[model samples]
Target: MLTISRTLSLPESELVERFLRADGPGGQHVNRTESAVELRFDVAHSPTLPEAVRERLLARRDRRLTDDGVLVIQGRRFLRPGAQSR
Candidate 1:
């Protein structure tokens, strides 16, 4: 299960997490290991989400949101030479 808040939580089935290769200079490890996480949530079809929350989410103008009301979130972890990137 994925915890969204103290009162609201989403089920594991509703939240899909996929790992992909992160882009950056990290030697062969970067090419071999998938460090990027892609989280996909079906806001329009998820039964766990309330109607008001779903409507509000769909009403927002977000480029990550699809026409089908699926929210795609990509989190990348890349290695840099210094702390400048951080």
Candidate 2:
């Protein structure tokens, strides 16, 4: 990974938010893990995203997109918040 901080022109504090959940292929174990990571970015309000990035995100027809235009990314790898890694 290219230094996570250096690779980003914006600071970590500026990132909208990151949600980690358990993604699965582990069968019964899948329900007990939260290894999936979802990135929740508010295209209309995140100060960290460049204008181009914002435009592109909003253009997507995602189920997570609210009528007001908030993008909701869910880490569905695990049904719960804590478990084993994927």
Candidate 3:
């Protein structure tokens, strides 16, 4: 389960995650490993979200929010093999 706040939590079943190969220039293993992550949350029909919160989230004008009320967040800043960490 994902805890959003003191009163809100989303079940694992309600969240969808996808891993993909990171884009852009990188080391040799970049194309071979799926280092990027995409997280999707369905706000329109989530049973855990309060109606007010759902409405507020959907009402926003964000590019990551789809017309179907699915919020998508992506992460791709993965450190390549043998690369030094900052």
Candidate 4:
């Protein structure tokens, strides 16, 4: 479970994570390692989210929110050495 706040938590089942090769600064291993992470959450259909929160999240104009209402977050700043495949 992922805790969003004192009262809100999202189930791990609702999250989808994908790992891909990250660009920049990993020496020769950069091309071979899937160290970057993309996390996806279905805000519009999440049963764990409150209706009010879901509506508010969907109403936001952020580019990370897709037309299908899935929120995509990516992290690529630091690469883990020898990160294994999922």
Highest TM-score: which candidate? Answer: 3
Per-candidate local distance difference test: 0.89, 0.61, 0.89, 0.90
Q: In candidate 1, what are the lDDT values of residues 1-86, reduced to their tens digit? A: 88888978999888899999888776757679898999999999999999999999999999999999999999987666664456
What TM-score goes with each of the models? 0.83, 0.44, 0.88, 0.85
Q: Per-residue lDDT of 2-79 in model 4, one digit per residue for the tens?
A: 999999989899999999988888866768889899999999899889999999999999999999999999998664
Q: Candidate 2: how many backbone clashes?
A: 7
- Residue 14, model 1: lDDT of 89
> For residues 1-86, could you state the per-residue lDDT of candidate 3 as single tens digits?
99888888899999999999889866777689888999999999898889999999999999999999999999987565667654
* Residue runs of model 3 more than 4 Å from their true location after superposition: 84-86
For all candidates, the clash counts are 0, 7, 0, 0
Q: How well does candidate 3 match the true structure, expressed as C-alpha RMSD?
A: 2.3
**Candidates 3 and 4, the one with greater lDDT:** 4
Clashing pairs in 3: none
Model 4: pairs clashing at backbone N, Cα or C within 3 Å:
none
- Residue 54, candidate 4: Cα error in Å is 0.5
**What C-alpha lDDT does candidate 3 achieve relative to the native structure?**
0.89
Q: What is the lDDT of residue 1 in candidate 4?
A: 91
